[model samples]
Target: MASTHPEHLSGSTADYSVAVPKSMFPGLFVLGMVSWTLVEYLIHRFLFHMKPPSDSHYLIMLHFVMHGQHHKAPFDGSRLVFPPVPASLVIAFFYVFLRLILPEAVAGIVFAGGLLGYVFYDMTHYYLHFGSPHKGSYLYNMKAHHVKHHFEYQKSGFGISTKLWDYFFHTLIPEESHPKMQ
Candidate 1:
């Protein structure tokens, strides 16, 4: 397994602190986690999956850098998680953005939640590819849905942790009709 450490994410000289009521942090964390699902869905559907023009080499390269590589090699373990270097940048951006738009305590809580959400999403994504789940189990179904996105429905089934957003956005992949095995 490849290390997901954000060794390159260090060296930031900024010092920041936010004070939040200890009692509220848990709820705020949960909210942050929940918010991450929507964020993940949006980024995946709109940004990562964006179709670059066939004639634009730069756009193609950008697409591959952002996500095309994963589609091309879905089982590459090292590439499965967001490399900490880039991920830290995005995480910082979100933290700063949240702090600017909301109260510091609220922002911190939500940011933490969102961060946890990203961790879960990455881990679950890896598991879906590499872990074997029992048939008819939740992970099994999730794995099936994800595999379909990779192999069959590239334009749909963008949801990984949950399919709620796909249903909400009407991007859910339609079930295929198959002859029952004898």
Candidate 2:
């Protein structure tokens, strides 16, 4: 039977009539991807890691449901990706929001780019937990940085697809300390 998941249906053909100019689409798409990296950084840092009150069981449970579980089980493959149901809702919201602020064609192209970026981020996060990348590679460095975020620097190192935001926000993990001259 055909899968009923939103992810399965997400590959439905787009309306090329609403597409941005061929030349501009690539630039706009890249801009959207870059914008997604910033959004990822902000949400991960500010929202996911926000500390709920000590006495509120409901808030604590909500925190666990949202993000604490990931920290609690960094290697859980099932929880790695945003579930398609909730993801679809967020995607729809962005689609409507973008359409409101931008031309339909431009918004579609940019939204497609942001969606692709989110896919990349989810896959990269899963791979960081499970796949072993070659040392000195980009994925290798990212995996190392992400591991530090999980285990050592929970308050920083929120960047996943890129470190640009962490650098911009001064939240990048610090290097190992070295002794200075006495």
Candidate 3:
């Protein structure tokens, strides 16, 4: 399966750090992870699910390559997580962006937290696609939500890791209807 090595991520982002005091790490880390959820939801909803111009073959192909392919073959494990190179490019972008906006120590820890959130998102996404969770559990619910998004609610239910964004954005997939039987 395509995956990012955490060691590489830590190594690359290390340059953006200067010596984050132990006291500030937890808060900065949590902030970063919280920031990531919004980013995840936004990217999934806007970019990955964007509809290209009908007349533009290039954009259409780009959409397919970026995300449609996942919907087309949901169970393809290798495609579930991004390969290291592309993932690193995006990660680096975040690191640099955060560095510009925040102190070095703060930015590094925040970036690391965001990166950890992303890893969790990827793992949760893969599990929702292929794992069996106990009925009524969080994963079970998320799996149902994700499958619905794939099969019937393409425009809603964009949150793969956590439903917090979906609830906030009001894009949640409505509850499934089941007809009553005598």
Candidate 4:
């Protein structure tokens, strides 16, 4: 039988991280998660979708590596989660950027929070498609929204884990098309 996996995704499996302590040690991790969610939304809507000059095929490839692969292979279950090494690299890069602008401790905390948020966003996205979120749950709705982006409309519904930004920015899908459960 032919495999139903998404062909564009990297074939390497993600090495998931171990659980951090739930106490203060993990607080930065949690903060990272939340901060990353908003960052994810912003990056998805603006940077990921940006149409660059046609002359620079390299730029196009970068975009594809960052996001186009996911759009092309939306149903690819394995591609949903960000691999740990790349994710850590991205976090470190952003942490340094934040450090330059804000106080060291504040930047450190915010960056940590953002990374934690990213983890949750990645897992939630993967779960939306692969895991079973019961009908009428928030996650179920998010799954529907994301599926819509893949199948019906790619121009909108970029928010996967949360619609707050989509709603705020007027990118949300119309209700008439994807109706909510009663």
Candidate 5:
């Protein structure tokens, strides 16, 4: 399903499209969002945090910009919502990379879906720290998990919208540290 929240459809601020589509089929868009979330979670927990070999200062710097800074300043609102220019360039790069390996139509659809997912994650992460979720909902739980990543343990709980990826990868923190949904 497409996100019911308006924030997921925009970027940077409420006044702009940023890197998103003006309108999209909700089902396809939601699917894209979820699939991309997994990809995003994986990339953040692994590739972006990779310990590059010696003589790879450029890669380490790139990682710092792409993700490390977020860990360093998790509550910074401006940093929370992805800046559109850099996000668009990254998305385009992914499109081209996938295009070389998949059929055109499939690649286009998946890329579109993944882009929508990234949009949702950026917006949701912003809200989790700034706007707040309902008192007792999955979003509420997710917000707590994210805050833990920032305040207590930076190494796990990488999932944003859901923890399925963390669970699957055995990167979930201890239950005592995570707490039950409020």
Candidate 6:
């Protein structure tokens, strides 16, 4: 059945977000955002860092194009984000999956939150590559963590937007003895 709320399909933020009770909306939004972090960590660790069999050149090249290229050229501004076409497909998959499990209005707000989380992840990934984050700040710590992952601990510290999962999964990079990255 078509949702009577045409605004649900429209890009109007207020319409879908307020579909739920005021108290429930905040928690659901945060849940969706945090869920994206889990997705990001899992995708990076399991897919992006997957080891292809040595005999299969096709898998090796595919891995390189999917993620190895980023490790090879971290500052390639052009490679900072998933290409729009591929990204849209992934986003659609998530939206459809979320809609299947949650009520229409609730799913809309949750998807909105997850979408925002994705944006933050991309921006943070780009900044960590190029920005000179202030020392002793969160971004600086994240930059140092990410730099360590790139240059040294490639097998660990998979969390890019936040290290909360790395800590939980026991894959957090060990504390650096040297001065943190500038």
What is each predicted model's overall lDDT from 0 to 1?
0.89, 0.89, 0.90, 0.76, 0.75, 0.92
Tell me the lDDT of model 5 at 74. 72
For model 6, the superposed segments whose C-alpha errors exceed 4 Å read: 1-19, 178-182
- Which 10 consecutive residues of model 2 have the lowest summed lDDT? 10-19
lDDT (Cα, 0-100) at 142 in candidate 2: 94
Cα lDDT tens digits for candidate 3, 83-161: 8899999999999999899877788889999999999998998899889999999999999999999999999999998
Clashing pairs in 2: none
lDDT tens digits, residue span 1-182, model 1: 65545543344222243466799889989999989999999999999999889999999998898798999999998878988999999999999999898777788778989998999999999999999999999889999999999999999999999898999999998987999999
List runs of model 1 lying over 4 Å from the truth: 1-24, 177-182
Tens digits of per-residue lDDT for model 4 on 83-177? 77887787778978987776555566677677657767878888887888899999988988888878887788888788877888888987765
The better-scoring model by TM-score among 3 and 6 is 6
Error of 2 at 152 (Å): 0.6
User: Roughly what TM-score does model 4 have, to 2 decimal places?
Assistant: 0.72
Which lDDT tens digits does candidate 2 get at residues 74-136?
Answer: 888887988999899988998899888887778888999998999999899889999999999
Q: Give the C-alpha lDDT of model 3.
A: 0.90
Report the poorest 10 consecutive residues by lDDT, candidate 4. 12-21
Please give the range of 10 consecutive residues that has the lowest summed lDDT in model 1: 8-17
- Which portions of model 4 show Cα errors greater than 4 Å? 1-34, 177-182
Q: How many backbone clashes does candidate 3 have?
A: 0
- Pitting candidate 1 against candidate 2, the one with the higher TM-score is 2
Please count the clashing residue pairs in each candidate, in the order shown. Answer: 0, 0, 0, 12, 1, 0
